[model samples]
Target: MIERGEDWVPPLPTGERVAGAKRRSGEGAAPTHPAKRKAGATERARELRLDETKAEYRLWGELRGRHLNDYKFVRQVPLGPFFADFLCREKSLIVEIDGSQHAESLTDESRTTWLNSHGYSVLRFWNHEVLAERRAVLDTILAVLEGQIHSPSPGLRFAPATLSPVGRGGGASHG
Candidate 1:
């Protein structure tokens, strides 16, 4: 072992070093408290809003400024541990725009489960669908917000097939 001078100092832990680097680089440092985490999440949500995908931008155009049924929609909202694409606090609704990567994703399924358990109804739309069939997607969201679409009970698993806009016989169905 090498002897150290009286002014010698030990190296910082790995986590601290990384955090220090982030701070020095002007990147936001990791939050250290619950409140700080919440604030960080808010900032992250803001960043996501600014860097939204094309599909997200299109949807926001329709949803923002209370353009959809006079309902206010916020984009890139941070919920428990997830960032919702859009959220209507009044209706307890969350809208998620999924890309191809989300198909049959177990993580998405679990996320939907958690949101449902927390009394939030989640609506998922394919990115392509949002871009190509904007009207239909808006219609589906409107129907749900208007209570025209019946969602499954809290404990019951929600089936995407049940709420499909296509083949609806003028009435919503729950599965």
Candidate 2:
């Protein structure tokens, strides 16, 4: 062993160095960065859950605790490189509530594509729809879950009155 200068750094393990080289050259699996990214995503999910939008909180009340048709749902779930607003692992479904910021967003499009490729059906509703048209939103979700409405390829964007309620007036009050 030889003494080193104050600014000298130790060499990485041989295997790690090789993996790092491979990653830099784009010739091998990513070198441990994905796990760190996942951890970051998890932390972001937790933060989002803590500061949930009003629409998200309202929808969660209806979806949590196996409340909807007794199917379990988890909110702010981390998935691969993204966090789904709500996910039902058993049903392979994801529900995303979008605000105005999501309008025509390329990032959202790619995120939806990634999610679809992972075998989950995504249902999207605008924040206003979730807040002002709560019944329709819930009905559409239930319809998709029950196979009454086929899962759209990739994902579906829903307008406030796009789908009518299952068996009653469209404006049925949740209260």
* Tens digits of lDDT, candidate 2, 1-175: 6843321222332312322232111233321321123435556677889989999999999999989989889998765556778986665678999988788554555445445544566789989999999998999898887778763543346212112332112243242
Q: List the residue pairs that clash in candidate 2.
A: none
TM-score, model 1 to reference: 0.65
User: What is the TM-score (0 to 1) of candidate 2?
Assistant: 0.66
CA deviation > 4 Å runs, candidate 2? 1-37, 151-155, 158-175
Looking at model 1, residue 129 earns an lDDT score of 93
Candidate that scores best on lDDT: 1
Give the runs in model 1 whose Cα sits over 4 Å from its true position.
1-39, 152-175
TM-score of each: 0.65, 0.66
Look at candidate 1 and give me any clashing residue pairs: none
Maximum-TM-score candidate: 2
lDDT for residue 55 in candidate 2, whole number 0-100: 99
Q: After superposition, how far is residue 13 of candidate 1 from its true place, in Å?
A: 36
lDDT of each candidate versus the true structure: 0.63, 0.62
Question: What's model 2's overall lDDT?
Answer: 0.62
